[model samples]
Target: MSYLPDRVPLHGPKFAADPHAAYAELRRMGPVGRVELSPGAPAYLVTDYRAALDLLHDTDTWSKDTRPWQQNQPADSPLVPMLGWRPNALFNDGKAHERYRSVITDSYALIEPHQLRRQVSKVANQLIGEFAAAGEADLIGQYARRLPLLLFHAQFGADDQEGPRLEADMAGMLDSQPDKAIQANINFANYITELIRSKRLQRGQDLTSWFMDHPAALTPDELADQIVLTMLAGNEPTANLIGNALSRMLSNPAYYSSLSSGALTAHDAINDVLRNEPPMANYSAHVPRHAVHFHGTWIRPHELVLVSYHAANTEPGPTADEKTAGGDDGAHLAWAAGPHSCPVKKPATLIATVAIEQLTRRLHDLELGVPRNELRWRPGGFHRALAQLPARFTPIAPDPDGVSPWTSSSPYSSTRQDKTWSPKPPACATSGPLYG
Candidate 1:
């Protein structure tokens, strides 16, 4: 609590641009540091990991409600409006939270991890094959953006063409006001509406079908909300992770080739990627309820405070002086910790694993089509993603030249045999694909 200097800096672009700098200073200052949320609102940063863990885990102390502070402040408080939705269990705590979140968390048990492995590898292969022939292409726009859509599509048994439009709408809501978020809500609602309706007619193994059968437990609209929320939370972060991971790995030939040649395991690749470039630099936690107090300062019931997931991962741990690449077991706060941690992180991890593993397995000596420094990353927020990740590669010898080509359209079929990708022989180069 005393970490806050007598004078605290106001939260604005500086804090958003790089909160770590301020956090680093705050950490040095000690436990709780003071900072301003707006012109009049005084807030404290819970910098110490022990204390932070307390806040993120204890629903009794903090309330997720925005009401207390919102009501106290003037109606036009810009701070009230700027803080966005935390729809998942991330914002809730205690009994009410456990009840709602349990529905989704229990659903995770039904996600066939083994089944997903083969399916996701196929998805990875399909996308990577597109760039494999050309030698390279933007990993983010071309694949990262598409892979999650593909996963969500298969997971819920959705139609092939729905992802792009839905993802775009979700992106729009992330920026628009809550009132305006309704449009996206409606768009997503309509889609899920139709999806569930059809499933009712002829149910499949997809979770949506499960919900359809359990209509006694969840109404069609509630089921649709669950699906919509899952999509919003799962889609972008996973896409950004894939983008961040691929761009980081593909940037260095030594690292890229190691995986391609099977020198390093996909497990190693995913671990290292997360350490170097986590999707979120920082993720915020809203107070679960009132009475959560850190130090002498009150996080005060429903108030919103941004926990530095970025800072927590990089900060010195109890035994180690710095962060370590411990994989899913890593103390890395990227997936968060305790009650608010992402339950689907395993599935998310496997999703990334499949993509990286299969893609690297397929491609040979990669040539950097775009300079590493030339790549653009999402700069202002937690999700640091490359706008594009382009690369080039030389095909294997003998009949090498015009190599394997990918199908023009992205596949929706989860079955691999039905979705065969031609690994065409590498082309004979006038300049050669790799040379180009």
Candidate 2:
């Protein structure tokens, strides 16, 4: 008999360093490989492209609900915060999923493409202006990470001051430390609770208000749950997308030049990243409703199954001509598939592409401060995020008119003046725990 490890570990620095290698090893086991997200948190990771699609599209056989799987997990398992059952669409099925997803999709639809592009450009300029004069900046920390948070805050009509807190809370939740992740979960819930209460009292032209006014008429608790899902789901992955795209462009001169000369668009770079180094590499968690054979593997009932977007996208299968004839755009499962695919795909793409375009345009000569090989990837099973993207460029000074040189000629030049809405304090404090 062929020898196989008990379970391949998806976490830790070793896997983060080169996950593709790990995925290759997992392939020896079959299309679906047994993997541990963390100690004692095992699942079946779909590494084959066809197998991943099979699982993603077969919602009737494989459920999005995680409660049944969570019941078998230790209470202190760090995965709970991320994969735990919630009232949102991510953990629901059928009508409940449709209802929750509609609110998000409808609210996002309210943000026109032009408006979203303008918003991304405005925030990109603001963030770039902070580091433009410094000659060097950690693009991931100063730009990629903050841009999405600020945009989400604007979308939700949240206080700018709360941005850092939300970012920290998100970091905690994604951290491997169980205590920190649990605590961050509590803090994030409180933050959403306060946001909903505030929006209920004073409505604004924002997603929170739109969610509240949506025909679904979600209850306060439901609203809180949905917001938690939306903000975290949108923020982290979008940030990683920006970071990954920028890293790829900066490390590859020909690619960067093509981007600058308009020979290749930001969309091209973004798409390339989506295909190879997707931000959320190993997610789209699903549970098999009952024991069944899947792609030649016998899966247990309620077994945790995760789709490895990175592995599946890069899995060696398609020929070059076949890929070309079929078109490579829709083949990747980065935004996932079927009932649980990403709802904000358009907005997320717009945000990342615009963010990269604005940054590269402003810092035309931006290059990696350290060797590309030296750049560190954040250790996690779910996300393919860079710890930092340090970059250097010729410093640009503010114009005599006190406007950022980067923003003065922007397409959305009047964005600063046009943005007038500010956040309002909550009408009342949220008391007690967000969940029982």
Candidate 3:
């Protein structure tokens, strides 16, 4: 495989600052272009919508197993921790993929949508209560990043106290630093190992126990892999989805008011993010099973190919008006496509939608503390994430009865007898200077 001398590097502040520009440049190279994930790691990025769909659906030509390509990568490469072959459904094909995927699909199936929404609401309220009195908070740190971890802990039967440690480890693993990423992977593995061990000794009505009890009969190691895969895949992306959707809605006042007024829904914001700024932007790694010319680029057997969900979804084509007139929202590839598409999209969507709704309802006057353009995007190749989402709101005091705002009948209370979930515009000005 002849390498392109001018491969675009996907890491560092430049790409993060303006990834759309990078995608636009890559489009000039045709549907697919050469790009470096890290300094020395080169891979082909599919920047066209049709090409990405073709690659994702062509299981016959492309394979998910990464072992062959992994052999050539440096042991300490930051990409190794993320792209290296694991025994989970993500790195397998055909029957093996089905076997591993079934465990996840079946386990998630046990979590009903209503039950998951209630759990998300509970976690969201707790997170909100922590910062409700402060008047200012980093939503990323205080809420978006932590809510999914707590929810996953509850589902996996891990103690709530363990959430912080897991969050730290997961962050380290995704940070794109070789040493920290590698060490975090080890720590995360140990954490899962212990969780599985405890579950064996005392099974509970949790995801871990369900995986163990499933008729598929995953071995202890297999169970650990699935758990790690599920947690890593579910937590980070969901967190980013929530943050990105919040950022979009908060940045645009008209959209925010429409959301609050129930004229526009959280689902609309989420779908907009999915199309414009997907959380897991450039991922869904696939390698050709044999030498093949894909979209005019010659790919060798076992060479890495990644689908740029961001680029593909935003590829130049019909305008939103044109798409709407045609009754097409121009479906996005944010959840990926084909057989290996996100297994838990429904629950993930519920988590993000409820998270945004809960925050908006409780702190109805919330506004970004920093200008929208000044917000920092975390630098990484695979994830489209914000480093911080600082925001300010009018501080709400605890109820006279000393009950938390989440359950209190205070003016800012979120608790209501109506079980139905709907957006209600706050009884305050929606537009104002971000911070006084």
Task: Give the runs in model 3 whose Cα sits over 4 Å from its true position.
Answer: 1-5, 175-180, 319-330, 399-403, 416-436
lDDT of each: 0.59, 0.81, 0.82
Question: Using lDDT as the measure, what is the rank order of every candidate, best first?
Answer: 3, 2, 1
On residues 80-122, what C-alpha lDDT tens digit does candidate 1 reach at each position? 5334333434444566456445556555445556666766775
lDDT of 2 by residue, 210-268 (tens): 88887888988888888878988888899999999999888886665544665666788
- Could you report the Cα RMSD, in angstroms, for every candidate shown? 9.9, 5.9, 8.2
Please tell me which predicted candidate would have the highest TM-score against the true structure: 2
Candidate 3 local Cα displacement, residue 330, angstroms:
5.5
* TM-score attained by model 1: 0.74
What does candidate 3's lDDT look like per residue over 296-322, in tens digits?
A: 999998689999989988888956554
Q: Best to worst by TM-score, what's the order?
A: 2, 3, 1
